[model samples]
Target: MKSTVEHLSPTRVRINVEVPFDELKPDFDRAYKKIAQQVRIPGFRPGKAPARILEARIGRAPVLDEVVNAAIPAKYQEAVVASDDVTPIGRPEIEVTEIADHERLTFTAEVDVRPEFELPELEGLTVEVDETEIGEDEVTEQLDQLRARFGTLAGVERAAQKGDYVQIDLSAAVDGTAIEEATTTGFSYEVGQGGLIDGIDEALEGMSADEEKTFTSTLVAGEYADREAEVTVKVTTVKERHLPDADDEFAQLASEFDTLDELTESLRERIGQSKRMEQAGQARDRLLEKLVEGTEVPLPESVVQAEVDSRAHDAVHAFDHDEDKFAEFLATQDKTREQFDAETREEAEKNVRYRLVLDALADREEISVGDQELTERILFQAQQYGMAPEQFVQQIQQAGQLGVIYQDVRRSKALIQAVRAATVTLPGGEVVDLSDLLGDDDADETVEEVPGEVVAESAEDVDGDAADDADTAEDKADAKA
Candidate 1:
């Protein structure tokens, strides 16, 4: 067996392979055995017929066809593994060129390959981040949040207002036809919370107990999804939350603190720590943006298209792939199909670009992900998806996506390395150090799991399933392997 590579472009390659008949003995043997089990020979038991006798009865063409079909994929994988420079990023378009009955078989495979490029010097790069300052108002807001957690709801005799909790019965109709799924009784909702429905907040305001108001809102799900409907909400009860006074007794009840002043001080410190962590996140995002903007990454068209198609598929999946319904859904967001496509393409390009750049950085730094890192990533992702770690692992393994997750973890670690190498500054021109947030070299070597953290800004967060798209592309590319 022999193989040679042809450089079709900076991001693609064509590999030509030739396998001599002697190297195809295993494939021929397997094909003959499979064919023997299906054919009946007079004096021989099932699957006991010899290859030559079976070929004589079934014809050479059938046996050769099965052999070729089985051999091509395995041989293609061999050719790929033999060539160190051919790292395919997309599925190969394979074409059998020739087959000599007793001599050799030849084929050519064209595929998208990772492009080569030099990374910019990370130590010289500089980025600006937001200032980390915890104001009194911010501390007060945190205190209010904590107090609200321990607050009690009491019945009120007045009209419902913002911040009041209301028990209401809701019913809706589209074109005078009742939507059964849209009807609910004794549903408890907070005024101004604004997530239950589109216009329920405004309809509930100023409604006294046992009062009802009819308003119009669009049903976002079910058979009447995306359709405007008349909605009637009857207020069964209205109640307001009452918080305890900020005193020593209340502080002792609410927390381990001895006094209200001590509690307020702790809240202020916690808020300050959160603000500083946010600043670290800002620094990571800014640094990544700078690196990506300054670098030149050659995009692979097939990989980008794969990502775009995946995103588009998901965008329409909720509508059962109904284009008209998807268009209507887009229209609700004031977006045209053309605009959605353009945005999808732009986002796909960015995602592919980010992946390629980080992959290159990881290679340059010789970064490697260990078993522990991979396990930690799996656990974190399982927690995010609300699945057990074993269940998540089984699902990903069944989908052949464990490698894609490994890539994600590797990319995250690479980005943390970039964050440490780059210079980050506050708005006031003071240099900011993220060593504590990023952890030391001797520590866990993982980024902090703060909200809006730097690692969260990666391409995986773009559509929250970009990794799935990448997994699909990788599965296609390495199908034979």
Candidate 2:
């Protein structure tokens, strides 16, 4: 195979490849033989047909096509690997020209190439991270939430009131047209949570058992495009919260802690974990912002158009059949569909560039996600999505999206290395702490800090109130379904 590379731009290339008749003859012979073994000539034994006869029986074009299809992929892969350019993530536009028994097989493939650029000095890269602090009120508030989680629902003797949970039968319509999707049976809602079909809460503010009420609400056509549905609500049961006593016994029953003191410390640790996650997210965003600022490449119109169409197609499908909110969304942003495509095209280019950078950075730093890291990352994602880790793994495999998950793991590893490899400088002259960004299984390294006057023990004494309350409320609310 003979190939010639043409640089269209720093970020694009055209590789024209030709298989001389001499090179293609062997492939043609193998393909012919393979076809001969399966075909029976009228007077010949199976697998004994000659190439000329087989070519005659099946036309030169069909045999040439088979040879070309089997040959292009291997040759394209070799040509890509042989060049300094990074192979594209998407398809290459391939056009075949020459196809004959004794003639060369000529084809041209246009592909996007990773832009060659200098790495901006990224050492000592720093950004201001909000100081980690556990305040007394925050700790107390957290404890109260935990207590709410442990709270039990008690039967109410009075009519349904605001903040009360009520079992309800619901029905809704649009312009007096009754719709089945607008109805539910035995739905329980906590007044003021803002989840119900509009105006249901206001109508149910003071209603006894089986009291019917009707209200009007403008459906925002947000996620559900049933516009301005008139809904009827009926209150069936009124229930009030009966919280557990916040004593040592309560602490002991709710958690591993036997005392309020232990429970408070645990809550503080949980809060710290949450704060660490936020800080890590901010750091990653900052790194991305910087990377975008430093990279330069000429993006092809085709790549951007493809990405925008893909994004728009997905957005349009999210709504009811033939109905799309993206048009409105684009309008709100002051962009025409064409303008939106142009903007998203730039975003697509950035994503492609970032991916290329990740590939290069990973190779240069030898960054890798090991089996343990993959397992932990998958489990962490499952936990984040409120899915069982093993089940989530199976689901990803079943859906054939595991490659997406693997790429996520690889990206995480690459992000860490890229940040560590760069020079970070804080705008406020204070260094950001990246201790939270390091993997848990990584060797322990003492972070630079004077222990910061020691975290106030008084603040850490707050109970696990907040988390408990959220869990409790979610449990009660979801149980009604």
Candidate 3:
């Protein structure tokens, strides 16, 4: 067996492979055994018929066909592995060129390959992020939130307004046909929260207790999804939240701190720490943008198209792959199918470019994802998708996406390395030290567990409000108890 590679373009290659008949003995044997089990021969048990006798009965063409079918995939993989220059990024398009009976078999495979490029000097890169300035207003806002958590809800005689909680009955109909699933009795909602029906907030703004109003909104889910419906909301009761005064007694009631001054100081420190984390995130984004913009990467058309197809498929999958339904769903957002496709393609191109650039940088920096790093990434993703780690691993393995996850982890670490190497400064031109947020230079240390730090967990953890919400909920429960 032999193989040679042809450079079709900077991002693609064509591999020509020749396998002699002697090298194909294993394939031929397996093919014969498989065919014999299916084709019955008199005087021979199933899968016991000799190859020559079976071929004599079925003809040489069938045997050759079976052998070629079984050999191509394995041979193609061998050819790819043998060529160090070919790092295929997408599926190959293979074509069998010739089959000289008793002599040799030949084929050619065209595939998208990773392009080679030199990475720019990362150490010389500089990016500016917003100054980390924790304002008193921010601390006050957090303090107010804490107070609101322990606040009591009291009946109000006035009209419902933003921040007011209301118990309401809702009923909806599409084209005068009532939707049973869309009706709910005694649903409690915050007046200003817009996550419910789109126009409900405005409808409830000036409605007093026992007041009813009818408005039009599009049903986002259920059988009548994406269709406009008449929604009637009746305010059964309106209540306002009364926060306790920010005094020493309130502080003792709300937190571990015994005095309001101590609590205020802690709130200020927490806000400052949060602001610094935000700055670190901004710095990372800016540094990555700079790296991507400063580098030139040849995008593989096939790879980009595959990503675009995947995204488009996911978008329409919920609609059962019905283009018309997807179009109607997009129409609700004031987007046309053409516009959506254009945007999807644009995003796919940008993603592919970003990946290619980061991959090159990873190679230049000799970045590697250890087993522990990979496991940590897998665990994090599993938690994100609300699945057990084992279940997520099985799913990704079935989809052949475990390699994708590995690459993602590698790229993340590479970006972190780039962030560490690049100089980050504040808007005021003062150099910012982000070692606490970016983690130390020790290669064995995982970024997911920075001591007493909140920023270095992961890329998504930088903006993690869920953890903060959980902490707030626990504190509130403790204070109430």
Ten residues in a row with the worst lDDT in model 2?
453-462
* Candidate 2 local lDDT, 120-144, one digit each (tens): 5556455445556778777788988
Top candidate (lDDT): 1
Candidate achieving the largest TM-score: 1
The lDDT values for all models are 0.80, 0.64, 0.79
TM-score of 1: 0.91
Please give, for residues 1-481, the per-residue lDDT of candidate 3 as tens digits.
Answer: 9999999999988989999999999978998999999999999999999988998999889888878876776676666566666666665666789999999999887877778777779889999988767788888999999999999999999999999999999999998899999899999999997899999999999999999999999888889987899999999999999999999999999999999999999999888888888777777677777877887888888878877898899999999899998988799899998999999998887777777777677777788778988898889989999999999999987654566676677677777788889898877788998788778654532344211111110011001222232222222221221
Model 2 C-alpha lDDT versus the unseen true structure: 0.64
- Winner on lDDT between 2 and 3 is 3
How well does model 1 score by local distance difference test?
0.80
Better of 1 and 2 by TM-score: 1
lDDT per residue as tens, model 1, 317-361: 988999998888789899999999999999888878877777778
Model 2, residue 304: C-alpha shift (Å): 3.2
Task: Give candidate 3's TM-score.
Answer: 0.88
